[model samples]
Target: MTSPRINSVSIMHYTRPYIELARLEKPTGSLLIFWPFEAWGLTMAAFRTHLPLKYYIPNLLRYLAAAIIIRSCGCTVNDIVDRNIDGNVSRTKKRPLPSGRISVRSALLFLVVQYLVGIVFFVAFLEGLALRTALWQLIPM
Candidate 1:
């Protein structure tokens, strides 16, 4: 049978569950992954130069947004890649992908869009740098 049409209400209803599946609802998981990046980036920037604190606020926001998007995309890709296993596993059987709350194509498209957005924020780091240096980080993407 063809897949049923997914509507706004359906999406809203599953939003909380989806966040759990993506681990956004879990603070420890996010902290464990993002703390190192934040510490290193801030320490490196501070160690590299002695500037005013306000100067780094914007950069901090850009990096935070980038990290959240990148992590969310990774979770989305994982769910898509492991749909079969998740469906069979007791732990993830109720997840968005396995429970028919999300589609595979939707997951891939979300990842692509999130990654593109993440790259755009990455360019903020290369703001004062040459174009050549920025190109290297993008080749893998």
Candidate 2:
């Protein structure tokens, strides 16, 4: 029988491609998406309303989560759409899709799952104007 460590290693190996496809290793994209918009907005709101730490911290985390979801979903879609072009570019040629590490069908399925998670997160954690704005962001993706 395989050891637990071996199983975990195998799982990581399996997920490596998907992780690359989402560009999770390089978090600059997600941070860029978050800080410019969400972080500043949250900071402004907290300052204006004297929002408590309890509420402020959790909402900040939710916004970060949303940023990650949006960035990953956008990357996956971009890679899928630019698979052929990416293969020709020196910098992007080794990406998951272009490198043959992942299939288009698999990427599509992953994209769908990402959207579902985003929707569930927005619905579960946000309400009123926040919820409406979050849902609207998904329209372009």
Candidate 3:
């Protein structure tokens, strides 16, 4: 018999619980986390210097993506940290980690992926000292 072959579709299907663990399915959480951060950053940047529409727009989009990823990481970390406590709570007992649908190790791996994507975007979008500094920010998160 041939060994199982995993493809992008299958991987994506399997990753659903982790995605839920990240709270991506719930728009409220991600929006609440990203919107203010994005608004503050854009307001500050726009206030500090006059950037052409072409430049600020792309950067704004990139920052939004970064914020979403960061928010997801925060949610995953919360779930992992609270897994035990969550198991004890009737409301949270059904969550991915507490429900035994997702392992702590798997959740951690998913968090790493989220971090890597955010780091890649920051490094690729920024320049020089900014690139180095941005990469450093990703390490802790």
Best by TM-score: 2
Q: Where does candidate 3 stray beyond 4 Å?
A: 1-13, 127-141
Top model number, lDDT: 2
- Ten-residue stretch with the least lDDT total in model 3: 132-141
Ranking by lDDT: 2, 3, 1
RMSD of model 3 against the true structure: 3.7
lDDT of candidate 2 over 1-141, digit per residue (tens): 965565778888789989999889999999998998999999999999999999999889989999998888888889999999999999999998999988999999999998899899999988999899887777654
How well is each residue in 110-137 modelled by candidate 3, as lDDT tens digits?
Answer: 8888888877787778789967865665
**Model 2 TM-score (2 dp):** 0.91
- Better-scoring candidate (TM-score), 1 or 2: 2
Where does candidate 2 stray beyond 4 Å? 1-6
* Residue clash pairs of candidate 2: none
The residue-by-residue lDDT of candidate 1 on 25-107, one tens digit each, is: 75564565556876466768776897566876666665565556556666776787889999999988988879886677766
The TM-score obtained by model 1 is: 0.68
lDDT of 3: 0.79
Provide the global lDDT of candidate 1 against the true structure.
0.66
RMSD of each: 6.1, 2.0, 3.7
Candidate 1 residues lying further than 4 Å off, grouped into runs, are: 1-11, 14-22, 124-141
